[model samples]
Target chain A: MPRVPADSQTSAGFDSNLLAFTRELRAEGVAAGTAELLDAAAAIGHVQWSDRAAVHGALSATLAKSPEDLRIFEVVFERFFFRKAEETALQRGEEVAGKDPGGEQAQRIDLEALKQQIATALQEGGEGSLRDMARLAVAAFGQTQGGSGVVGVDVQRIRRSLGLRSEPQPDLPPEDARAEGVPRDRLREFEREVRRELERQTIERTRSLPPARPLGDLQRGLPTGQAADLAEIHKVVAQLRRKLATSGQLLKGQRQSSAIDVRRTVRASLQTGGVPVVLHQRPKRPKRPEIFVLCDVSTSVTSASIFFLAVLHALHDSFRKMRSFVFIERISEVTELFDRERDFKKISRAITSDAGVADVSGYTDYGRVWLEFLKLIESELHPRATVIVLGDARTNGRPAREDLFGQIAARAGRTFWLNPEPKLYWNYGDSVIDSYSEYCTTFECWTAAQLGDFVDALANPRHLPPSK
Target chain B: MSNTPKTAEELASRLTADGYLADTQTALVAWLAIKLGKPVLVEGPAGVGKTELAKSLSRVLDRDLIRLQCYEGLDEAKALYEWNYRKQLLRIQAESADSGWDKVQDDIFGEEFLLERPLLEAITSEEPVVLLVDEIDKTDQEFEAMLLELLSDFQVSIPELGTMTSRSHPVVLLTSNNSRELTEALKRRCLYLWIDYPEAEHELAIIRLKTPDLPAAVASRLIELVAEIRGLDLKKPPSIAESIDWARALLLLGADDIDAKVFRETMSVIVKHRSDLDTVAERVGVKLDGGDAASAS
Candidate 1:
């Protein structure tokens, strides 16, 4: 037999590992197609195999299509390529040794000393030491002694015990922070490092996790309406809008009625010696659905309302007419704010602070707000209009305006109610979802993915539920 | 100039010589684009040097740069090619009625009357050129679809004339602000690279390179302040371009360190928005003022 190449074994291993990694990425929603996979494989051949950063750059640029995909690609690449077998074996050895009573007592870490080391690391502002300290903290405090034969990592508990919750202590004076030569932001960075290590440990412990959107998993506990979250939502909305536009499901009827463009026709006639033999027509504009959004801007449902407004703002180009209203106890038309400000942050701020929507207490009053909304937009309501109501349906035990909601549903061609709370939490406390949900279709839109599905359905009128 | 970079590291150094400090990812993607004869789709926030990357690549490759600035109604006539309509009309009027239609068509449709746009020029050029399609996200989907033939096959099709393929392969770069999602078809034809805000050390090096006269200490300090400001959740973060400007401004002012008073004067060099200025002055201003107090004590 002919002699094989020197690095044949390693190269074969790398190829198989890369193929598995690409499949893992696809299962985790990275959108890596065959083209990207081939590009990644070809790219790896060009870079030096020993140079880790170069290899990472090549694979990342070839495989990851978007910034979101890049993030998932990085995490998977790290876990797959650098599993640290030695560390795992070492940890397993420790676990086996600590099974005995005497060894278990010896393995116990001093909480006070660990806390002191973290404080010193924070004050010194050395990233290397801080990261080492985070790993130590995770090793000592992150393990959960479950009653069942299972080991789990709890980063939140470690954060609390180390007094590094990513949120600065409100009572700590700025002067003290300056004196310590380390700001609260530095501590926050250290805490993030700890969280990352804990996540890695969890992944190692489980050996496999259910395929999930990495973004959804990371931002599970994050409060909504953050700028980054808004950006992510904006991207997803843009994708949905593109899909709806490309499908042409909504533009079928409108194509036949397109008016001829006179200017283009005249211009085209010049090429033919001024005789208008061939007529040039304008591209038919789609028949756009009219939209009216009545959003609850009360403190309880502020997050959901912000997201709704953002989604509608992104989809404004696909609609013929649109209007927005923000309400706490009364309705105030704030469509001008959207028209005036291109920045979402400014629009959100104006809606919450200076839009002058709240006429009474801060509590949500659905009955009065719905009555006022009907009075405001009753004349403008038409058969082609789609009315969307965004809120938690938490009326604070106020009178439910079932009749007013029914009138809205009757006047508008379609009515959709998007509640930010989960289905289980719908009728638990002061929520009156049942009172008004009968008049319109209701969707639980607590996450961006749910909002995407709701908008996708809204774009296709045939999928809309019948209004009662 | 005739020598292309043999490796990503070489391409990165060549780009640095042209005053662009590209990270490993950017350099690798660009090198692959050259080696594979594909385009690079650069996406990021505004003011992050998406356009500058094209200019730098053109300079590094020693090729003429042809730019197509896309907007809301950008069409084939503006970006690809356009007929000299007025000239065509004049020629038609000048032609005698006795002359046959074939003669007039042959004369007018020749290269003399065909007005080549940036895209057509990049393709038909005798020498290779760098084609930059800037802010492609602003164009409508139909225009993007029109570009698919040109981008994938390096050819343009005209109804008046047959398809024209490029003899010299031009390096192509398309930059988008990501205002909207581009079609997947366009993305599939190019290598993707996202150039985010540079890290502190990387940005410091950029400042040092761009403004050599600025003191190293002052440049590092300015970059530190910029990083801290970016840490805050502002509507618009100061980009690397703004950071370099601020460093030059500080050098021109002959400032040793960034104190609160000095910062207030030169703050506009970095922060542009009215709201951002207020926030930066409050958050970063306190740190500088606190520093002043401690030194004085």
Candidate 2:
């Protein structure tokens, strides 16, 4: 649990409300785990409670880690924090009792009867009637974002089984609720209340019915550094890719060549009475940066390094030169392996279980890996190239060849060190950060936010200055 | 005058005086960070002035702005503190050959050879310090982890020299361009602030402030046009810095307003990517040259 700030003097009622709201968010499939909820509570303890934006902004910084999570969080936040539902209800002095208690709300549409009626319509040669009903059924209930290969949406299943439609659109908020001029927060509040009502009714109406997957589940994944399995990690990385792809920042090198250069077009056409005929672009694209990634696939950094590599592969278009190296003891170039295998599981398996990267000791050597990888890339290393070395930096009693790192720092535009271990362990035993600290900036990147921010910087280096 | 801001509004006003127009949220966050003495993690896209805020804070508060520029391979020697190894080695060598190792230990690791990097300097400074950890996401994870200790408690523990604490706590502002996600532990240690591209009006104020000689008509048109270009699905969006550059570029080219020819010639200033320039030019051509043709079509 997050330790509440000592200065906090919030009412007990506010704390309970915060917890209940967290539960609602969790029910909506935002993996806003225990730690995050505690952080949220602590966050609320500060600032004037009357300040809506401050509360929202602080909670947002703590809770929303991804775009989809941000979306769901915004909805849940409106429903919980900014909500006037129960307040207005009590203020009106209206006895809104029962809320149609028991099986009343959930059984409004009987699935068994609806299925039977659709079957009958299909048998009666009124195919259009079945189509209309299916459309209506899907619109009323849930839908799927096709190609996920999960079971069809509950409403779409009866129709798809009858060979009506092959694909369904992604489940989004209702039309009236999604419409503009309604202030999205209010709509989100309405949507959540409606969904919560449906959920309560469904549980009451049919006690034995299996619950449908929440619409927001597709966007949620295992938090960074908590992926214990390989296949699951792949799925999370894929989700991360989708999130990044939808972001406004474009990975510049790909699909950028389509637009013609107009300034050059007008300049060269001055001889032809301002009628531009032949274009005069440089005929070359802007210089793309070379990124050399040296990953420490030591036992400690394996899981995180895989995630780092997966994200790098997902954003492949962002770099002109992308090279990857993995080192446990001896350094080996794994860029070809990553390019060849789209499946991270296959790549991870082949590299870790198959390849003999580990020396006889199965240990990490910061000294030899630094010296050896530099030797490999020294000739080809450009002053503009940015080399990223991801590892825990535990030298394991081997001499930390600090000079080679310094030498690489001299060769490349910049060198950065990413240690998966917490900073507390940076100097513990074999972790020799003092030796390598002189070369480049190091950061604690045990979270997805850090990795995402790193990729964002890589994709948009134009705004940054040349070198430190 | 109170060197420590008494209110968020005061800080905001002072920041504006320093030529940084922080919004209510940014002002509030900065105020809280200052009052609480916690590091403020300022995050946003590039050119949103995350670094500028720290600089402005230093100027406004009348403190030394200590900057630690982060990149890959940045380690303690560069970031936190570096022992003058050559001096230490020379000192040890110059000492009596028969002297014990413990005899010269205090002499080598003392304050003289202790070269304080940004982090150590900020922590150990006698006066007020504003530490700007710029582009923190560009550095490695190890560097990120190292910041956690310094950020959490304004102190550092050295093996040779023992623990060093600050006389006056520095106002630490760590900025990231969303290059990488900083960990929860790190975020939890500080207040968070994110800055987006300013709306038209604020940007206009900035443009006028930057280029005092530019015509008001041209500046408004330029802001409107840049906002439109940003709306387009271009590779690299034009940032405020680019907008200022474009304003300057227009003034140099002697264009009062963004006519087609002037816009076409000066498009490169605002648009970094060739593709965006092409798109902007075509749009201009349609709006300016194909006015009747577009209407007829």
Candidate 3:
């Protein structure tokens, strides 16, 4: 039998700080489960605690599962471990009245002196000193915009004054540009440190964690209307795709050709004296549902629509037919653009700029879009089509045209209205979700997780829709 | 006994001695995998030496490398173990009619009639081994699910013969190109190590170590140009392997300088895709032409 690894807290007593750090990582949307936490805690015993990078690596290998998670881990590691301690020290300085806290109270920075320090740090090429220089630069130059006390680093001002830009300036002579190469490269590192420091301070002051999503809660809903990074969204999309594809949910009501019917083949072989002469395969099922996606391309719901359309485009092959339409007031078919461009960003750009889907007002008018679709494209809807509407349902107080939507919904097999706005905000303002919910399935489509749930419900034939 | 490194720093040095310039993170992760007795899932863009890390670990630890190249339709019979059905049939036929039924059944199902695939071979080997599962993302979920039992327990179960456990603990490394997201169950059981492209300095050191004959200055220029080319929007960016190949090509040509002409002549060594050639030439060409002008002055 394989030897069981030692317990996470073997010799040293369990540190509550590590537990809190893992919680913070979870809050930031990393799926750092109990198993990973134990691994990380156990990993601490193997690495030297004094060597920060070594500890970081050990914890990262155990806790972070992907590059995206690693990015979050890097930010959280620096802030939670290093920045928190320094902040406490600064608070201690505050308690001591006039005594300086490691010279961190340099409010008005002398530009030339800071530049000299950066240049010296660059020349020495020591990462430790460069980090110290970043702290110094952020303390001296970082300002509280409009006295709100929200820490924002003034990177451009510092970089311009220090001549740290890498691009060759038209005014600067060629040799001068070449001479600034080393400093330019080092300045990028310095700027990264500044940003990290700024993030740490901002998070500290706000007393709230940044939007993080754990991957384990894909079926559960996410924070509504929050913008996630493209890569994170893509990861969630890929995971959802793998789950939906493998679970055979997408194969519902569709013909799957691979598996043979042994019983049927045996029964058919009886005609040939049980010699298995003619093998029989399972008969094909009914065709998969066609999908019609009508998305709101207004600025508020554009990201959600992009995600929705991207997911649809990815699973386009599984369905019988898939068509997409985008509208700001004027509705236009973007299925051709989705077909032509493989990248979601390009499709989003085309819908906004080149697809001629926007009106003069640039405001989302749900009634007008529905009316236009009803007039121009109602006949194209298949009887077995799944009509999905992706929007906030904020129709700018215009006529919601529930009658027209009901007509569209009655003609199709099923209709799903995904509102990017939170459920609490639904029907409070210009949102006509209450009127439309009576006619079709309505879901609060805020996060990618919710999108995955909606897709699951849409693909799984056994999953019944919510009661109207 | 296995020669696993006592510490991460020692592992780093050992890997360096094996000619794999692992950064601190890679070294620490690999060491922790060994220390914790877990598999390391190494993921990154293609050509970042994810497979090479497994090989270097095998060499450094004096373990035999047992590789399983995963592809589409990879299944239990190919990956774990397969019954030698033809041999079993022949054995059954060769047995005398007078032999008892139980004797014939046991004789055909014996170990001699078993064909050991990579997983079973690694488990059954007497010496310590390094199990490298390459391009794991290419395989589907069923294959991945089949691996979960073997990965977690280091054992495989054959219905006729029962479970076959490992004699020695083998170091396991699974490399992925991140083409698809692997199931969380597989990831949870393994230590994750993501190897992105190395930094310019690290790449320089790698070039120096891998191609000692190439002039250091020329290698630096080639790496810098390659970095520039990577910045362009290309279908396939030149990876570290391509960088080393470019360095070896330059050394073979006895080219001291990489001006626009030398770069144009040997650019195909790195840029593989035909569609990317125009874009790379248009973008990286400017850098080389500028370098040529600077050299002339």
Question: What are the models' TM-scores?
Answer: 0.64, 0.52, 0.64
Q: List, residue by residue over B60-159, the lDDT tens digit for candidate 2.
A: 9999999999988999999899889999899999985977788788788898999988889998888979999998889988888888888888889898
Off by over 4 Å in 3: A1-14, A83-125, A139-147, A152-192, A195-468, B290-297
Off by over 4 Å in 2: A1-10, A23-46, A65-69, A82-88, A91-468, B93-100, B252-254, B289-297
Clashing pairs in 1: none
> Looking at model 2 chain A, which ten-residue stretch has the lowest summed lDDT?
A176-185
Model 3 docking tier (incorrect/acceptable/medium/high): acceptable
Q: State the RMSD for candidate 1.
A: 12.7
**What fraction of the reference interface contacts is present in each model, in order?**
0.50, 0.11, 0.71
Q: Which regions of candidate 1 deviate over 4 angstroms?
A: A1-13, A82-109, A116-135, A142-153, A170-216, A219-226, A230-468, B85-104, B290-297
- What lDDT score belongs to each candidate, Candidate 1 first? 0.77, 0.68, 0.76
What is the model-wide C-alpha lDDT for candidate 1? 0.77
Q: On residues A70-175, what C-alpha lDDT tens digit does candidate 2 reach at each position?
A: 6677767765642344444445665432244323333365655554454444434343453445443443344322222232223223333332221111232233
Candidates ranked by DockQ, best first?
1, 3, 2
Report, to 2 decimal places, the DockQ of model 3. 0.32
Using DockQ as the measure, the top candidate is 1
